[model samples]
Target: MDSVLARALIEDPTEDGRLPLFLLFLAFLATFLITRTITRLIRAGKGPFRDRVAGGVHIHHAIPGIVLTIAGAFTSVAVDGSSPGAEIAAVLIGIGASLVLDEFALLLRLQDVYWEREGQLSVQVVSLTIAGLGLMAIGIDPLSDHTLSVGHLVIAINLPFHVAGVLMCVAKGKYSTASVGAFIPPVAWIGAIRLARPHSAWAKRHYSSEKRERAADRAHRFDDRYGRWGLNIEDLVAGKPTASPAVSGQEPSDPKGAA
Candidate 1:
């Protein structure tokens, strides 16, 4: 029973359950094909944010499923007379729960990205908080299951993950593509914090351009208003000012060589 418990801890389902084995193989093939196709699409710049996040979520969750499946299969071989059905049941329950929870967390992270891009502060805060709480709940809930051997491990693993997600939000003020990549873990959060500050280079370039444009516009308007005045000065200097009006009861005098 110690060996059984140890095998159950890993909860790999692929080896023991024939049906799951087939499904696992099928899922692996599908994941491979989909990942390849998505890679090509991404290279072609046809993949959007949703697609990338979705793909990441799928692969991320699938990895654990594959692992558990393999462990399950190995466990079946070890137990000479144990019912594969019971083993598969426990694995499926845990794995299914895990996948749903992981996807939920990813969606929450995606919401942060969305809110960041849209420049919605309230939404960002709310989404990140909710996602964080949801992840915490998932981690805690799994550990409450007495039958699962690795429930404690799952809870332990998620502590760092949750911290990383929170740090990512703190680091990346706005969620750009690069910012999204900074959601990996502690390292990602570190990168994000480093990148989160404003882009001085971009700001400087934009400010300089705006200043130049404003200066040019001001000069243009000044020239438009003062050009006639300047011409009048030139005329006065050249002895060709506009003719003055005649005084009352007096005829106007025309200077020599003046029209």
Candidate 2:
């Protein structure tokens, strides 16, 4: 099984660089999971591991991740496409990206929000990245999933409709759904047709009072049924968040703020 998998990983029939991408996907997934596990253990104070600190500065993983990603990307670009160097570069890029993305919310806000409600954005981003990479690694062509031809004019004609659906999904604040639906048309349609989240921009601007109430009801049911489950899994994998975000002086001793 190991040998077969190895063979498959190296296979690049079209030589379009899918092999490196696949390795990157696998490495990214592994690195993120391992990093999350280590961080959780560090958070719980259950292990010898500690967050990296240097000269009174908390060294976030994003720094190293940025360096590695830049180094790997340059090397990947420079090396022969089929060379072992490309594969090695892919692994480096993958590891680096996982670290960076694991703390994406920090980069977004220019602060340590790792253990806050805002931290959830990092997980969401990472999840979408992984899913998108996985799909591409499997050689799924994007958009219409086929080369353009005169026979496929319908696809070109329908492209705007799909884009509209994706836009509506984003407006509805079903961001995760929108990310997936950017590639998969059916998902976009479903999200488009569905009621926007009660607090979404679409709902706030367009929904009438009665529609807003209905949207809220639907949102509550969805959260109860599925959203909470996703959050529970996220908490299990990443560390559980604190009741409130740590203010600089409020919880200085709390390690959650250190990240």
Candidate 3:
């Protein structure tokens, strides 16, 4: 099986500069699945595994994740790009990313809230990372390919438009749209021209009171239409979200708060 897989990777034309990316994706998926399974089992009190306690302090997995990340980063930087070592480095990085992102909420809030609503952030981050890796593996180069093809004069003329689109999308709180728009100019333009999210920085800074109300309405409608579905999917992939005691009384906040 290993020989066959290796031969397939080597024979594939699109995998030329993508072997590490493929390995990274595989490692991330494997690590995330394994981690989630173990965590769930622990949560259910069905596993022998317990939290690692050192000196009466419970150690989070992210500690080891950080170390692995640093080691993988350094290894990737030090080794030849074309060497087989790069694959090992990619796998290490992927595993590290999975471990760290699995507890992303703890890192963000500086507290243990793995089962809380905030934990959804981990699912979001992991999903985004996976999507990004998938795009790269499929040969999407964002701005690089277009920039390389254009002449200096054309690039000079087009650069500002691209920048403006990206900036506008970001300001309007359209992150995923902005990311895609960076690769496909039209997507950026649409995001830019669309109404800013009501609580977004752009809306606060630039929108009139009336426009802000309209934006809020639109945002509400969008959330009502798709929010539950999105949340369900996140739960399915990353496990159900746990509610934090402090924030339990408050209304459920948007996942990408005021992005």
What's the lDDT of the predicted structure labeled candidate 2? Answer: 0.72
**What is the per-residue lDDT of model 1 for residues 100-203, given as tens digits with 9 covering 90 to 100?**
33233235445321112221222223334333433332223344445554655655666566556544543333222122322334444444344232322222
Ranking of all predicted structures according to lDDT, beginning with the best and ending with the worst: 2, 3, 1
Q: TM per model?
A: 0.26, 0.68, 0.63
Q: What is the lDDT of candidate 3?
A: 0.68
lDDT of each: 0.38, 0.72, 0.68
Rank candidates, TM-score, best first. Answer: 2, 3, 1
The C-alpha stretches of model 2 lying farther than 4 A from their native spots are 1-17, 142-214, 221-227, 245-259
Show the lowest summed lDDT stretch of 10 residues, model 2.
250-259
- Give the total clashing residue pairs for model 3: 2
How many Å off is the CA of 178 in candidate 3? 12
Best by TM-score: 2
User: Candidate 1, residue 79: CA error in Å?
Assistant: 27
